[model samples]
Target: MEHSGFLRRWGTLSSFFLVLLLAWGRLYAQTPSTHWSDEDRISSQVIKLRNGITLNYAVQGDPNGPVIVMLHGAGDSWHSFARVLPLLPANYCVYAITLRGHGLSDHPARGYSRADFAGDILEFLDQLHIQHATLVGHSLGSFVAQKVAEQDTGHLDRLVLVGSGPGTHKAGSSEDEVTSPFAKLTDPIPYTFARDFQASTIYHPVPAWFFEMMVGEAQRVPAATWHGLGASISAGDPLEDLKKIKVPTLLLWGEKDSIFHREDQEVLLKNISHASLKAYPETGHALHWERPERFTSDLLAFIHSNGPNP
Candidate 1:
């Protein structure tokens, strides 16, 4: 009887181990092997908008192919998409921009509102003579993209919003309160604070190099810019304005995202006329960082699809 019991327990343990191995294999297959060397093929450039703001950006792939304009989140530069860019096909013309008051972009004393950022993007399209392009934005950049789409510049072909919310100002939310952490930030942001902030956005493991790169990027932003951007994000509710967006929209959110809840995505879907949502399982706010390979696949599929806008 003792021998029989031991055999039964061993069989169960083996089965459990097998299940875990398979699950890990699936996750490993979906992650990109991104390295700092992957950025070597990308070229950096700067363009001065008509408003006299010089924006730094990185470009890759064929210039004549379908255009993709990527806007990074607050305190992030074009490097935010470093992993995704290398995984993209050679047929795409990707431009990842560093928004004003961040990265190497010009930092004005003011004008950090979403509308101001949208104006810069429109002017950028005009200057580059890009007739049509897909606009991709993450977090704060998503709000800016929405503002751009509202203007109906006739240049946006599609829209992709990652880690986005309907709006940043929830009446009783701790982050929106006047005494929020962002409100207390001062110049020369501490390395630990920046590291912790970046760490809080991801649930899965990323390359240590990539995480440190992101932390460095966060520290580059001035406290005043952070204050301005934070205020702009909370200043208005874009729920009604989202109705003005006529292009096909895709929202990619992480299931584990604490910053923006699932309800926020539902609110976005209800407001945007032709928007759809794809939630990533076990992922956090920085889904792309955690699952770059999967993110690229989904983005390409959306771009190639000709389904009727619903």
Candidate 2:
């Protein structure tokens, strides 16, 4: 009787969730995030790189304050940063870059290394003639942020690595993903790029439409880009370079992150000098998206309290 009752309850809940997903697909149907936005009310720049790669970036808030350069992770465009932009305190200029092949940016044949992305950022800053900026990176973006700091850019203020490590961490490839429906219990993929960041969390009063938007985003990227980039970021260990980074660094992790586990966090903390560590409970890799208010509050407090930008 107990087993039977449990099965019945599980079935009922599953059915309910299915309906929610379908409703989101129909009711909140949104076009591909890649759709261009004109009149965004934000300063926009199109940078053509030295290697024939073109990237798109958007700036918001006070243009005069210390600059903040944000980098998104794999399979995500600048839209991933869309949530935190408006929440930023006024007078802080924030620039979000859409990586090649992700959003409006052109997909180049190669040159997807961390250095490649950092080079683009360096060029972008030089073009604008900005001297210094705070670097905020999420996931793969975190890795890029470290590189920028290492370059001795003379303008790098500090580094905030969200849901990422100071160096290479244990993540897997698409082939390593366990896709069985029951396998949902074991998340082999980082929630950020999967577009399932919402479902991977234990967010209370979970907004019904957030996960649905992720599904829409996954559909926008071709299967090749999805699998290729995931493989790329997970392919090697990049943490040995962490010691080279001299800027003040903040390392954040999701409590429930399956990809970059606590072990990964500790290892990163050990390598990077006195890197401050913070973890969100019951949250997966995309805590920022899953819990925006709490995430921003914690982020801003840390930023303001840190001794005058390193």
Write the residue-wise lDDT of candidate 2 on 38-139 in tens digits: 225466678887767788888887778767788887656776665566677667778888776566787664566677778877777777776657788887
TM-score of each: 0.85, 0.73
The list of candidate 1 runs beyond 4 A from truth reads 1-37, 174-179, 307-310
> What is the lDDT of every predicted structure here?
0.85, 0.67
Clashing pairs in 2: 167-239, 168-239
Error of 2 at 205 (Å): 6.9
lDDT of 1 by residue, 1-310 (tens): 9999999999999999999999998887666544445566689999999889999999998888888899988778888998799999878899999999899999887898898999998899899988568899998888888888889668888999999988647766634642256667997988987888888888988888789999999899888888888788668664788899999999999999868888889999999988999999999888888999999989888888833221
The CA lDDT at 178 in model 2 is: 20
TM-score of 2: 0.73
Q: Against the true structure, whose TM-score is highest?
A: 1
